[model samples]
Target: MNSAPTNYKAARRDPHAVGTDSGKSTRGEVSLSSPDAMACLRRIAWLLFFTALTALGGVRPNSLQPPQQLIASYNDEQSATLRWEAVPGARLYRFQISEQRDFTTIRTDALLLPSKSWIRATIAGLEPGKMYWWRVQAIGNSGESAWSLPVRLSTNGEMVGVPVERLPADRSVLAFCSVLRFSWRACDGATSYRLQLSPSPTFDRQVIERESVEPYAEVVELVGGRGYYWRVQARRGSESGQWSPVQQFTLLSLANIADAAPSVKESQRLRLLKSDDPVPVELVPNPVADVLTVRTPPLHEGGSITLFDVVGRQMLRMPVAGVEQAQIPVGQLPAGSYTIVITTSQYQWVGTVEVLR
Candidate 1:
């Protein structure tokens, strides 16, 4: 009976020990479900959802803008027209023009309407021999876009006259000598024409010749078998046109003369040659008295002589109408050296004379 009671007490104690171990296991699992751990898991899930939304938004399609094609045309010597293709979403266009190649110095700017694809505006009062650059910019609701490719335009520097279709016939090559003749169509307002001969194209150090109310000019005494350049200008009062295009000619040797016998009379030929040569002047008595006599070689016709002081101040101007000699009254003149210049339709000559009395 004592052994049976002892076995039953041992069974009851074993059951109670099992119940305590189960309770400890439940508490351990509950501790892992703390507030901090749950909050961390919620934050991770929200971050992933936001990242997906942002990625999807970036892939949406946006409007595309491209540069427009431009076309340019010249309206006149100093003006031009600009046109371009229209942009679909553009509200306005900005136009810029410049004289420099890099567009650093802008000359003009205009804001144009978006509805029109072509615009005509005169670029007047522009200088000659200059190049211009132009471009267009499209403005949209979002922002201003890139500039169009630049277009280049050039203005005419040579001025053409009326009634002159072609230049005068080129001079014939004379044997043992070279002859160069220049001709041009006449301008409406020109009272005289000036011819310029130069070794360089710029004509900075030029030899000038003049003709009164004539359309043709002859240049003689040129070196044979040598190339010479020439240009022409028309003048009326203070207004003078731009220089014409340059022309080149070569002289022929005397052996190349077609006919040895002169077809043109000697007097006529001398007149023609003298018209292009510088005039010759002689002052009588190097040391002059109160009155001095000036003599010039006989001019063909329509020539003149002018006198100036040593300092290039004009002293006297007289017309030459079949007169070779003139008496210059220097009674009240200052005691100094003076220069006398003789100018013919085709020539200009200068000589110095002293006044000592």
Candidate 2:
């Protein structure tokens, strides 16, 4: 039969001592129910619980909250920038972009540390017009927390080229408007446009900079009777064009749509190509400061050459008798975007021209 040991006063009273006789006067005798032994058992059980938690799926300090208000914007059609709120005490962050919500086809997995000032990442080589989803996870010594809520972003699909007709035609006087919506024609396979709104004519100091997949953008928060300038440029994948000429419009209490529309009717304008495939007349000195030359034509009917503002206002018109094409003077025309309409009695050929001074 096992004999019960006698308790040592110093050792049994100590709850934290490692050795049963660790106290100043404690000896080797210690009872099984001593406080020191009980404390040791409790410490072992706590350690076991902690080890099990780390090995299992229970990460410490609770699951990380979903990325705060994830925002996605595109500087180029093939690339995007993502921004999120930084998580406190997160030593590591993992961001993933995928074509599918389930992340079956992952495009990018960006790793970031908590010390970063901005919790953002720029991902490139993405397809335009495709739908993508992104999520973020916070990781620390304790383990990884739950993934953030997925954010959906639809990439821009814009046309490439210079802007065409605008809501407020060049040199337009507004009747009334609090918000301005600028519209332009779309080019084929274009992915996006860069826009600038400025208070100055030269756009030296722009008030707004925007990138949009659509051909239109609406700007708000403007004071009445204030004149503003705006311009846009478009780009495709791996290619881009120059910025368009600036157009100015003044604000007022009047908001008549007709006041902003071009003087000429859009639907009434006739546009005919050489053979319907390849363009016929290619305007020479495209950014014509003085005379614009119209070359290339099988004009059979002594066509007349006419230049119209972007809004469709016929700016210059000259009758051509025997020549297939001719040089037209536009020195008197204001600096803005224009269209060259070369109409022969047979077919009306349409082309684009710009006046830069």
lDDT at 302, model 1? 62
lDDT of 1 by residue, 1-357 (tens): 111111111011111111222233311122334545534654575467446645655322123253465644444445455556767666555666787767885555545555544333334434456787878776555445677778775655444354342232122121222333455677753546778776556767645565534677766645654545677777543345677777554444434333222222333313221224454555677668544566777765765555556655554444555667755544334668876656665556666667775
**Residue-level lDDT tens digits of model 2 in 60-97:** 65455545656555556566666666676565667777
Error of 2 at 228 (Å): 2.2
Residue 161 of model 1 has an lDDT of 57
**Clashes in each model (backbone N, CA, C under 3 Å)?**
7, 8
Q: Which ten residues in a row are the worst by lDDT in model 2? A: 1-10
TM-score of 2: 0.33
